[model samples]
Target: MYIPELYKNENQEDIQNFIHQNGFAILVNQTDGKLWATHIPLVLDVNADGKQVLVGHISKLNPQGESFKADDSVLAIFSGAHSYISSSWYDHENVPTWNYLAVHVYGNVKIYTHEQAVNSLKKLVDKYEANSENPVRVEKLSEKTMREARGIIAFEIEITSIEAQKNYPKTEMIKTIKISFPN
Candidate 1:
């Protein structure tokens, strides 16, 4: 991640908020000399000891389930709303660019047990069902579904480092705007 100093954001709260808002992330790791990626929704969790962790699951059938190992480095990427910023939007001449918010979480992967996998699924259900008119509780899941869910591989990532950026050349942008519109 080549982050320019002007675009880097080191605010922990902001990073956490962004991750919560956009929980769906891309988990990447290397396996068999190849880079493998999995798209999954991870819940940001704080343990009793105040340690941060990311919890998610992947299908047992997926090779990534076998690829991930304890303490192996992983990268989870969360991308927020983004749009093309046309150069024409500026009064001054500039190149067209894209503006977006992105957070990169680097961590060590730890696989969870069957019981923990079920709990992780329940927690996800509880989170998303909070605002629904008729929330579908995980407890109501059928025995068959629960059985199948147990076949999934649950994992946690203990975040080691996090880097975030809101893509905008702030200083240059402000100066360019002033030049474009002198009032």
Candidate 2:
């Protein structure tokens, strides 16, 4: 979250797109006296109040889920492609570095009710299965399969802040290098 001014991306549109493209994010929060983290697919949505939120779920057996409380602060990190930039790539001597894109979303937790959780799960399924050749839907799922939902805890994070960063070579520099290397 320590983004240098030069690497910071303040474009809201780009940040949202990044989150959508990299929907699997690491959710972090403090539980009891220790830090808890869960990697899950989170979808961005607008609530009935028109406030943006991130929705996701975790196994009910997960300790992280047991400790979640309304208004508890949490962090969701979405990471994108990264690669090592060798010092040899530069004309002058320089240290090697890594370039990547990432977005850190801060929010407050809001546990969903049973009905709300089911609805959220339905939307999540529909979103991912939309383009599948044989798409499956929550409404069409068998009762036995749907009963498994009882074992999970769905929640929403009311977004409070977002910090996005992209650390990469300038476009012209990359183009020039590609032209020189002919690859």
Best by lDDT: 2
lDDT of 1 at 50: 88
TM-score of the candidate numbered 2?
0.91
The ten-residue window of minimal lDDT in model 2 covers 174-183
Residue lDDT tens for model 1, 50-131: 8999999999888877877533889999998776777876757889877678999999888888888888899999999999
CA lDDT for candidate 1: 0.83
lDDT of 1 at 26: 97
Q: What's the number of clashes in each of the models?
A: 0, 0
TM-score of 1: 0.87
Checking candidate 1 for backbone clashes, the offending pairs are none
The model with the greatest TM-score is 2
Candidate 1 Cα outliers beyond 4 Å, as residue runs: 167-183
Worst 10 residues of 1 by lDDT: 174-183
